[model samples]
Target: MERETLHRYRDIIPDFDAFLQAIRSERITAVRWNPHKVSRARLIEELEECFECVEEVKWYEHAFRLGYEEKPGKTLHHILGHYYIQEESAMVAALVLNPRKHAVVLDMCAAPGGKTTQLSALMENTGTIIANDKAIPRLKSLVANVSRLACLNVSITWNDATKIQAKECFDYVLVDAPCTAEGNLQERITLMPRRMRESLSRLQRNLLAKACELVKPKGIVVYCTCTFAPEENERVVSSILERYNVKLEPLKLKVPHAKGIESFGREQYGCEMRKTARIYPHHLNSGGAYIAKLKKRG
Candidate 1:
């Protein structure tokens, strides 16, 4: 881990010591039950057989934290698509989106379909979801997961989300853009070069701005990333707010999280940045993420 890269967040993150400790701690293993395949009770019953601990994550329904030694991915139930081995914090995006049944939605950069499958479960497999990824190599995993989870209403596509030629075509759009993933400290930490971060920021802004264009008037667009960089999170979103007709909306999430920072370094963002939520490793004993919900104006 680059100490300097993380030290930059010292003043911005509350209880900085706890944040550092949580990032260095062993990652929590969690899974979300597949409502399309099995009932919660039945899945928990099955999970208990393989792992000694199967405690529900109180903040989110159908998600549970497993024993550190237990591998949920190896279980037969998992092979059958009974549950998804997703990080607890990663589940927040779909919960915040809350796409309704029978609505039209687009999941831009939806490879490896964690949130995409969760969206399908939330919509009860009734709505249409266009699951897309720009990278051709990643689509295989996305297709497999959507199938395993019984996401009957989903249609897969391969396209650069920023270049999609759709206009006002969806009721909801999810821009879970690719990022530096600084939040996944549990995996490994590496120095992020300034040039690379800037390049990703440009890509993120384009993808999110395109999402705003694709969503219908008064429709929702949720942008999220697994990194804590304000350049990628707040700055990119602030740019969109300036150019687009979308407004930030308060996220009615039940999970514990920090509000987005209004200022980062010398950059000053609008107070509305506070409406966005920041999930820290300390908050969930999982990974970190930043989520912002926007509604296109009529």
Candidate 2:
């Protein structure tokens, strides 16, 4: 991590030392069972022989936290589409969206389909999901995951989410916006360039605005990111609330989390910003994430 980046988070993150320690430690590997393809009980029974430990995620019935030595993807179950290797915190967005059966949904930036497939499973393949992404190349992975997961309800499209033609058509929309990826310290990737970070924040704002526009009145939009940066998380959602008729709704997640910051630097966001949840690596013993649920007012 950069010295400047460490300094930036020093004041904002409480227990900064623990946060630093957590990010530097090994990341927990987790996977969510594909209920569409297999029963959770049966999957766990099958994996019991292979894994030293396979414990269910208390918050999500279909998810399991694997032992450190477990290689979930290499298992026959994964090859057969019985499960998805997803970070437990990343699953929060789809769970927060809570797409109802037969409800129209949109995954604004749905490539590599972790949340997209999860949405399909939640809907039980009954509703339609317009899964759109700007990058055509990434669509292959998206398509593979959806196909593997047997998600027939999803329709893939290649386009910028901000420019999508559909308006007020979806009951639920997810903007798992691109961000600085500061929370994914487990990957050991370089810090995002300052220029790219600024650009991504702008893109996140536009995508979230479009999500608010695409959902029906009284519908829900769930915005989330894998980074700890408020600029990409709460701040972007705050910007959307200022420009749109959406109100922040409390996320009813069972997992451990920190409340979103109402004031970042001198700027104070709406009080409702506290409804958002911020998951740190230290808090969950997993990668970090931020999630906010919003409802569009009529």
Per-model TM-score on C-alpha atoms: 0.97, 0.95
Clashes of 2: 0
Pairs of residues at least 3 apart in sequence or in different chains that clash in candidate 2: none
Top candidate on lDDT is: 1
lDDT at residue 28 of model 2 (Cα atoms): 73
CA RMSD, predictions in order: 1.5, 1.8
Indicate the TM-score of model 2: 0.95
Error of 1 at 198 (Å): 0.5
Model 1, runs deviating above 4 Å: 1-4, 187-190
> Lowest-lDDT window of 10 residues in candidate 2?
1-10
Write down the lDDT of every candidate, Cα atoms only: 0.92, 0.86
Q: Pick the candidate with the highest TM-score.
A: 1
lDDT of 2 by residue, 90-177 (tens): 9888989999999999899999999999999898999799898888789999999999999999999999888988789999999988
